[model samples]
Target: PAAAADEPGTPQGPRAPLHGAAGRPAAPPAGAQPAAVTRTEIIDRAKTWVAAKVPYSMTAYWSDGYRQDCSGFVSMAWKLPANEWTGSLATVADRITKEELAPGDILLFHNASDPQEGSHVVIFGGWTDGTHTAYTAYEQTPPHTRRLDTPYAYWNNSAKYLPYRYKGVTAGKASTAGAGETVPEAAGPASHGVAGYPGRAMFGPGADNPYVTRLGRQLVRKGFGTHYTKGPGPRWGEADRRGVQAFQRAQGWRGGAADGHPGPETWRRLFS
Candidate 1:
């Protein structure tokens, strides 16, 4: 028999049954309407597994009752009315462009001819830099759930991974600023003591400057400090990237706008 579509590697022995809320099968009810969700909520749901370090298994289910695999991770994150697999996921989502990629969207590579080979799906967290050559990917693979800085599309099968957006997603109340738009001056207390946004060159890989420190401190002040394990120092690190990404997502920014590298708009809102 072919391997499960979501399992990329050779199948392992069945995992010990999960011990928590009773296990539920990974099947959605007939005719269920997926609840409306926001981009922020989807990313938040995806992080729950990362926090719990949920193990991956095609046959197992998590306490919250989703299958413990790549597709199931996405089903839970999208808050779909029921579980979905690689084949069925697209029925509920629309194919999107790479430029349209945003937090909560997915980069899916499903193999219909052979379900196992390298078929998989990952939640698009945000871009790691302006180049769009890499991004933050949240996935459930062997060992556990992980948030990684992945190459465009994926490390393997780069050409096959296509971007998708869930049809039921709705933009939340926060205002979004697109790329190249002039970021208005912050209107409230957030503007106080906030320095102007330095050029983009001040941050990203190999950037070591006081502005990086300032950005890190402001991120911590704005409740995104958890990404930092130690100093929000002058040097840029994964923590800084993740912290900035979280702040950008909070503002309803997506795609290039939320690339973790702070643009002028991201700066205005973070300080605001």
Candidate 2:
């Protein structure tokens, strides 16, 4: 998911130099200290960068020496040790609902279990109105630090926009106040079943196995499991295959092309 360019950055007017003499990340904007930044300070610095129109690139890191992808941007703002991926980042955050979204929270798109279809993460700036139908957000997408509006065509297509709060940051303040928030690093490769895709691919109706069972569950989640009348257990029956085919068709592949097999794209979309 973090490997490809799903959303390209567009030209956001004039650009400012964001690197030091050796091309390292430049200093923080006015009023914010990188050593002990606050949640509000994080948002403020992000907003300032947006206003400065820093360019975006999936392969590049930010001026602060962090990867430039969605998750990388979050890690940079949150001040993590290295660039983090979307799947791993989700582990450190508590899932929240749209009603619970607040500044400093993350808005993510795509399946966290197995982010094959690709994923995007943005920082919630604030609500555009009281209705919560729309809101302002900041993200590193094509162009730079984009001020995104909710219900955006590409991001609002499915039940993928998840809200998350870093475990260290709290309701009204950072965990350590003057010392800034001390985010807990994710432990290990997150277990897939409950939080990610089971480490293996579920491409066919093989023998009864955990991968098949996981496939069935994903199919059911995608609303393509009409054939799963009994239940989606560990069995790899016709139901699972049919469900996969249906999902493939929905994704624009058809007939022989939509064979009930999981290819790279099919797997990505199914997990996504």
Candidate number with greatest lDDT: 1
Q: Would you estimate the TM-scores of all the predictions?
A: 0.62, 0.48
- Tens-place lDDT per residue, model 1, 1-272, is 13322334623222122234654444445566667886756776787799799999887778886778888888889987566778778888999999888778999888878767677889998776667898888998987898877788887788999999999888651122223343233322232233576555456544567999999999989999898888688877688878988888888877656657676667878877
- Candidate 2 whole-model C-alpha lDDT, 0 to 1: 0.56
For candidate 2, the 10 contiguous residues with the lowest summed lDDT are 175-184
* lDDT (CA) per prediction: 0.73, 0.56
Q: Which runs of model 1 end up more than 4 angstroms from their true locations?
A: 1-31, 173-272
Q: TM-score of the candidate numbered 2? A: 0.48
Cα-based lDDT at residue 70, candidate 1 = 87
Question: What is residue 73's positional error in candidate 2, in angstroms?
Answer: 1.2
